[model samples]
Target: MLNYKQKKNQPLKGNRFLISVTVLGSSGPIRFVVNEEDLVGAVIQTVLKSYAREGRFPALGSNLNDFLLYCPISETEALSPWDNIGSVGVRNFMLCRKPQTETAIDVEKSPSVSRKATGSWKTWFNNALTLKISSH
Candidate 1:
């Protein structure tokens, strides 16, 4: 029988990988490219830099503390609100990683005015109906 650790360390041939990244702050997934041998740190840097180039900055936990990277092979599995990753890999493979979440996102929300005093009816609209009369 194959040992668990032995089986886990099995070598892999040159294979293209499926890289999926989930950015915490932005609330979504991310993408990356690597030859597998590259350290997980490199990929994370690549992701963080990509967003930084766009003028958005998020905290990479690994930078400040021992943030462990966990790569879930199955996307269907449920993850918590704070389960970020910085896992490792070897050989040729695809990577599914999360982008660094932007702490301050520029949300494009239009200025909303309070219509609380619009009588008993819902009459909060931009264009108002007008009635015209010819005083002949």
Candidate 2:
């Protein structure tokens, strides 16, 4: 506990933090800024909604629980899809930066080379079953 003299000199404390993020998106890189104290779900939802306007972002967490998250800056310098605000020390931070990617386009437009559309496990399993049956 602080006396009147000490308390007056100390600044007030509350939820305040800054964090940056990097995401790998289909359309390339994107960035965002958010409060550190925000909920993990809110942060991820914001990032996905801001950058992935055309697709769905699967809940990123432990055992698909939808609560796990990451920090922006650390001594090790690692990045996660779900980063927390307090993890970094700042009031605002970049929340997304999807590295641009290069994919080769074939003039023939072969179906084999085309990227698979967004799908779930069941969809992938069904496709695998179809391919297996067709091959046999």
Cα lDDT listed for each candidate: 0.38, 0.42
* lDDT tens digits by residue: candidate 2, 9-117: 6564455444444342232333554445444555655555554464534322222123223342332233343444455554322332222333455525664665544
User: Please, what's the RMSD in Å of model 2?
Assistant: 16.7
* Per-residue alpha-carbon lDDT of candidate 1 for residues 1-136, written as tens digits (9 for 90 to 100): 1111113465743544556655443434566554444345445555556655655435443341222233444323322223222223322222223333423332334334322332211121112222222322
| lDDT score for candidate 2 against the true structure | 0.42
How many clashing pairs in candidate 2? 8
Question: Every model's Cα RMSD, please?
Answer: 16.7, 16.7
Lowest summed lDDT across 10 adjacent residues in model 2 is found at 59-68
- TM-score for all predictions? 0.35, 0.31
Backbone steric clashes in candidate 1, count:
12
**Which ten contiguous residues of candidate 1 have the minimum total lDDT?**
118-127
